[model samples]
Target chain A: MTSDNTKPWLRAEIAQWLREGIISDEQAQRLLERYPSTPEPVEYGGGKGVFASLGVLVFGMGVMLLFAYNWAEMHRYAKLGSIFFGVALSHGLAALIKDPRVSSSLHLLGTMLFGAGIWLIAQVYHFSAHYPDGFLLWAMAALLMAWVLPSLSQCLLGCALLTLWSAVEVLEFNVLHFWALAVLLLLQLPWAYWQRSPLALTVVLMLLALALLVNSWHLQEGAALLHACLLAAMYLCAEHFSPRMSWSGCGSVFRRVGLPLWLALMLIFSFADAANIVVQLDGQTGAAAPLTWSMLFVLGAAWLWVLLDKSLRPRSPIQIAECALLLLPLLVLAAISGGVHKVGMIMTAANLSVLAYGVLFIVRGTSSLDRRQLVLGCGLIVLLVGLRFTDLFESLLARAGVFLLLGVLLFLAGLRYSRQKQRRLQEQRHV
Target chain B: MSRLRAILLLLAIAAQLGTLAYMVADKEAIIRHGHTVYLRTLPLDPRDPMRGDYVRLAYSLNQLYPSRLPGLQGLVPARRGEVVYALLRPVGDGVYELDGIADRAPESGVFLRGRVQAEAVAGEALRVNYGIEQLFVEQGQGIDIEQRQRGEAGFRRSMEVALAVDEQGRAIVTGYRWAPLAISVSPAPEIDGAAATPRLLVQLKNLADYPLAVVDNAEHCGVVLTVVNRLASSAAAPCGRYLVSREDIIELAPGAVHRFTIDLAHRRWFVDGGDGLQDVREFAPVSSLRLVYRSPAALQEASAEINLWRGELHSAPFSLRGFE
Candidate 1:
């Protein structure tokens, strides 16, 4: 309080200003606070950076070693031990690293070593005739690892290798192998779902289907049918699960394309079997009348259902085309059942119906159509009509005539439409 | 309201269309052609009762084993998409000589040839003649139906052979075609048809790749039983019956029929000692005799006795059809 000129923590000049009251004590204090703590020059050291870099080098060497140790040449026990050691050591090293970049790199290396080790183990077990259970154990281990490291590539690798092993086991007529593979597939679904990995989901679904196919051979008719039904169910489940994942652009495309393709294939497969049912039942029971009539009834009902449903969602061109195509085979079957002569009549009628629909679609699409809609609608109509006429006019002369007529008409229409559109646009601009 | 109603209506319509489509697709015709008859069914496998893996077909429609065909020596220029047909001339009973498209006029008995086509359908252009393949009892039942039901039938037997021919129609047999197959026929059962002639159900279960052909003999005459019915047994559980319920028989080419006698009369007619009326009463003959058809490689001729007592017929259990 008595004007201490030698301020305890301040420089001499600053202390004088505080004592004379040239500057307020608060300002002096503020100035002192702003001054650097240490004015002395400091020396530099690169120790930590060097140490971190060394760690990375060691991890890289370990990766090289991991690759060099060929699991294929090693005995089963050695392979198993090596895989265990490799996975543990690499993962542990990864966990100890603190730097994000270094840790992620280490994690990746560890996962690769782990995956290679597991795959090697599977291969060894797969080839070993004495140890049938080796494949199952390997599959289980891979499945467990997938769950533990959901984001790691190791998970997918594990799932895939396990799937292959399960396939072999199934082919060998091992029921246990079939169920085990199924379980692994089922486990991958949720993991893939949780991880939002569409790729993993797709692979798992495909593998499941393959396993079903292999197992279907040993099964009885009832069992085989059941297996097919199960496959259809699994596909349905996949379709349901797909929307939940953060699909990539390509994945989205596949979802759009692949789902429809898969569904169409399923429909074809189902229809093929359904068609055979009529013939099979007729032969077995020697009762063609009931079977034929029932088939017709069923076909009619299906046609009507498709037409009504399609009318409701008129926007979906694919659905409309599918429904229409589905009707052709049904009509053909009906015609065949009636007689060879009736088949001819039905073919003509079907041709006319398709042509009319095509023309109507073309007109509507052209009038209201954007370019894309016009192209799609006209293209579809032409294709349908062309296919129908090909079937309708069995004689080469008639078919050639129809084909030429259609080609000329389509060209003329397209040319006229373009010319008219251009003229209209020019007139509007002038006005 | 309209949207919801529309959705419901759409669904109803779809269901109806699906049902109708299912019915139409299911319509199939079972045509009987020549000595061969065709029945449409969801395809079935002809499994052998004894062998777990193979089936014994009722008829042979597959190409002959490559070894059996006379002159398929080396590779021939096969068209890319054109189906190649081979004409097989019979060398002996159940044996055939093979000729390619280039081969000259051929003597014929029952010729088995195949066209390799782009697709399974009748018109799919054939690619080449691997060999003289035979048709199985149940071949191409419906469009795509055979492939669909193949899984349920277990293992399939394919005729293995390679055939080649020069432009002159002269054929050289390259190698003997053999399939890992076993074929057998059940003894004719002793059941009287509504017509009183002993009705027989002969099953040709093809257990191997070689198409099974039983030369129909003049002695055995009845509708070649295409539809086989399973006669009930008293035992709750019976084993060794591969085709327990029903099956379709494969059709054979005309004039290829071989004759064999199926004796309907029983060997024993009288009992030695019994009750006074029973003693005087003669035992009526009811046992059935049938010809057994084993393939060319079979050690013993395939035959069986189907014993009938009081109207019940019993067949002797045999080994798996293909293995024997």
Candidate 2:
């Protein structure tokens, strides 16, 4: 077993060492008896079992479909009664689940069913025109459930519902909705922090990114550049303020949310179609540009906090450079949509930056000896290369050749890295 | 801490379930015990896009003139889309009419809280939907209901919908009844049209036991084009360019089939809604041709004054692509 393997078979290793005269019998016995003799009230399993929970989700959906199928035939009270019964019954089942994972699954099913039930009743009562209003009520109810149950699944469901609700609100109206969303979410942020849930905070930041996206959709042809800027700023503020915000408690959860988002934005902005959105000069898009000021103001506050606080310095050069790259376009567009002139150059710069960022990620990951980061970096580079080939060449032959060439290069690189890692491990073992 | 969480969970469940039950119970009570009101609805109403599985309904009296309301002076609507409680008083036999709007729910009379969708200050016609603007049917049923309703002729067939409304300003649609069709109109076969002029085939089947009589002496009963564009979103889209009104009286007997032909080639055509008469040979390819003919109540020709339940009849949408 390697030293860094998360769960080590230490007892067996110690026993073997003792047998081989590396340690005394007493030492082996002492080490073996190290576990606590006391029994715990709630015993948690090692990891979340994904499959069991998935089964329950499928079953719950099946049940919901069953109700909707018989909707017209069923009695009005029976249809309404069944929903309450399902919610209560599912929660009742959740109470019996001793396994943390299965319990969480029950809670999720209960939450999803609750949502379905609300929609069903809404249909039954003919509240069809004002559909978006239902989401607000549903999200609020989920928040209450999250508070009472306090699980990852419940919090996640609530976050998603609220995010969707806010997105719809923004699409309905631009700045007015954006302001309402900001206030609602910003208020929820402290509550999430008080819960010491980094997942919750990450959800908040994620929802903000989604809400910010409404600007691009509602404002322009498809202002991917603006969306990228807003998202980058949001990620930076969250990462920087993590310590003060109590996001320090649950480590790497923010990374789980932010990295994929950043990658998606990069991929989107890499395309020429997205660039057209920036270059196309439309009066409506120009007027809507001021709607992003509230987000930028929040980011500015975070930057100000970093500058004034002596204890909290900026993390590293890479982040600062990326922030600069993100903010550069915004700074250029500050006159609010005159990025039209700078569009072509901005497109080239964005494409180059994404490729360069991928390379940097590889170098940083290799130096730190983190395989996930290295693979992720390599995967991104390979993806970008594949994208370029597919975009440039319509013929399948040219694309396949490029794929084959990249595969050979990646295989050689991986072989070399493995050899180097092996040599390092040998050196450490000898020491 | 675990015990406390369990208790909290119990309280939360109770609260949610309690509220849900309360709402549902109120609605159910309306269905069980409330004054029943019926609306005579035509099938050609437009639908809202947001509502996927439902049909958006515009009632004939959805937009009401303020003068119709007995106490209309007090009901100045402040804003649009505001949920206003509508006070409906019984005007005739088993028919309750929308009397007025109020900010607060009325303690007496059949009341319904509806969001005011559109208001015409000058026209004084306020359009409101009491959450009953939609009829959510089981998936593809909306299309079917719409087709049958539109395909039917007015005098012989009709559609009626009933709803139950309580004093608490709640309303729920209770039942729907589509009129029966005896004489169905369809497009004439293209093979027959190739030889002569393009015409419609009106097939009248006596689905009932009573004898029926219609116009056999007149050369034509009604002339209308049923533009069959499957590419069209609505059944009534192309029909707007055609026409909807005209009455040709006919009499039929029990267990009989009456077939009438209307030329689609070149003919003098009068617009359904408008009185403008023009020579139209333009209706070449058609899907459905609606035939409107009145039937005598008794088997005699002079007994045209009496109109019974669904005395009017129209045909289903028949298929036709091109005509000579």
Candidate 3:
């Protein structure tokens, strides 16, 4: 109940005294009562929940196998009866169970059983329609379960199945599944938002990014540029939504995935041959279809909306840098599509952008004294130098010289870090 | 749980069960109200660890030559994965033949909707997959049924799958049976290999109108005999690549019977060892034996005038002691 900073220290001391036999159990208990333990935050029940979900998955597979055994001697009605009975039993058990872990596990099992039933029925009746339709149904059913039961397992399964469905549709049929994307955005996203599960949100965002990338794959030359735009849009969207999010640390998921990918794409573009290849392919393949233009328009609108919203706040240099990074890809894409074959000029600009971004990060990190950002900034420069050395210089002597320079710089950085740590320790001791 | 949640849970469970029920009812309705058509099936029995055994059914209608199809000769050829409809006209004997094909379904006729598995090109057979190309069977029964459907040398049996097609051009396999072919197998007199390793004669009669190219094993157009042990365990004889030249492929006329001699003891026989099935040089006396003939796959050679019989056939079980 005490708000004093030393309460934790005192509580730990009391526990240690109890353990060391200096204080009796009753006295320790009475003292501990004066400072009640802080309640643990809610989490997707850690290892136990994971194992239980896995157990349910395995059990679902077992049930599927048993049905797949295709007991030839059994009548068709018997098989159908068994499938229905199994689904009903699992759902019933899920409903009756009071324990959240057990109930969620049961619900997962029930959802999976229902999916297996769909396939099993197909097996029994020899129904072989579009296989993705089966997955679509399964995903819808799992999503319904997630909505009705309000469980993490159900939501995760729904997301996974929905992704699988979209992937199959795109890969197998070469068709962009707009309906799948619609379901994810309209149905799954709202559920995740309501549930307030960061994990689910992370999955939803990752899947959304993946689905967009896969769906836009047919744009061919436009795909890479579209990807950069999409990723930047995601990052900005995350920033825009962060203020509205009630939960702490939820917005970091988008940045965690998007920023690195954006940087990676920039690094890739910095290579001379990458931009050259894109330009060459664009020339041969010609301009993208009307659909790609419309999609780009939508994505551009979204990016603009988020960027406008972000601009209302006091802008950081890093935000300005990110905005520049997003614009650069669009400029390059437009140049390539406009019949510009100046690969060397574009590559130089890309390389300069990467160097500038790295320097900007280093400056920010130094000013903020943030180690992670500083390391990232240094790592980017190192990677750029290393990659440039690899392709630009064929001779061993030049390569060795580059390596020696890198090694010396790393040694100096390490030495500086050690000195800083020592100084911090001394200051702490003095205080 | 809240009352609203409880009701939702009940609805969810009902929907799950209803989905299963709908699948059953839909298939049943197709069987009841749909037009029944029989098509030939050449199935390969394969085992899946998860799904047990399934027979991969290849039908005669799977491959159609657009050049041969009068209706589709002038039309644009179907690309791979594009949906096409095949108009099935009842030929005779409860079987259907591919009479015509179209990009869209026929207004009023027995037709099947299938995806183009391969591109339709000139002088090449266009492959289509009807999605009814697999039949799940009991564990260990796929091979049995596949073998049984491929009758003995003299009594050739080919399987015909019965399909029920709804009005929407969707079809489901209702049933299948092993039908008869004109081919048969008979043993000839012992060759001059003396007493121990006696030679046996094997013959195949080509019944189809097209010229059949049969792969001659070791220059002998003979079938290998697989022995079934007392435990009902059977292993295939050790197979090796035979250098099949143009001369080695015996092209048979429509009514021609291909006869050749095979020395039974020359090839290694399979026996069940402690570590599963193993092939041995020694042949033990077995209760029953079956003839297995595997033909060469279709030749890519444009000069190939004969249709290569590109599948395996297993003869009905007969005792080697009878020949002895």
- TM-scores, all candidates, are 0.32, 0.68, 0.69
Candidate 1 docking quality: incorrect, acceptable, medium or high: incorrect
How do the residues A1-431 of candidate 3 rate in per-residue lDDT, one tens digit apiece? 01112344455456557667999989988987854644223354478888899899989989889988898889988887877887888888877888989988988888888888887877877665677888889988989988988877888888888988998888887766767778888988878878877678777877877776677675464464545544554554454455445653445555655667677767787777777766664533444434445545665675676666643332545666756766666666556655677777567766766767676665544443446766877798788887788776788998888788767765665566565456445544654
**Backbone clashes, each candidate:** 74, 18, 4
Error of 1 at B223 (Å): 55
Return the top candidate by DockQ: 3
Best by lDDT: 3
lDDT of 3 by residue, B119-232 (tens): 766446677888788887888888887766655434565677889999988899877875423334455574475445544566666766666666775534335555543222
- Which lDDT tens digits does candidate 2 get at residues B207-304? 44665434432444232333222111112223333321224444455556667666644333322222233223433233343444433223333434
Off by over 4 Å in 3: A1-45, A221-229, A244-248, A281-334, A337-339, A349-379, A395-401, A419-423, A426-431, B32-37, B45-52, B70-93, B99-129, B143-157, B165-170, B182-324
Chain A vs. true chain A, TM-score per model, equals: 0.45, 0.68, 0.76
RMSD of 2: 9.9
Worst 10 residues of 1 chain B by lDDT: B305-314
lDDT of 2 by residue, A1-431 (tens): 01011112244456457657998988777865753232211212234544565576577667666655435677766777787778887888888878767777877777767776766776676654556666666676667777777765566566677777767765662323554356346655665666765556666766767766665566654554565565665664455554454335432444456657766766765677775565564523455455555556676677777656754544356555655555554454443354445555555555665666666666545544557766877888788887787566688888888788777757765765676566556545654
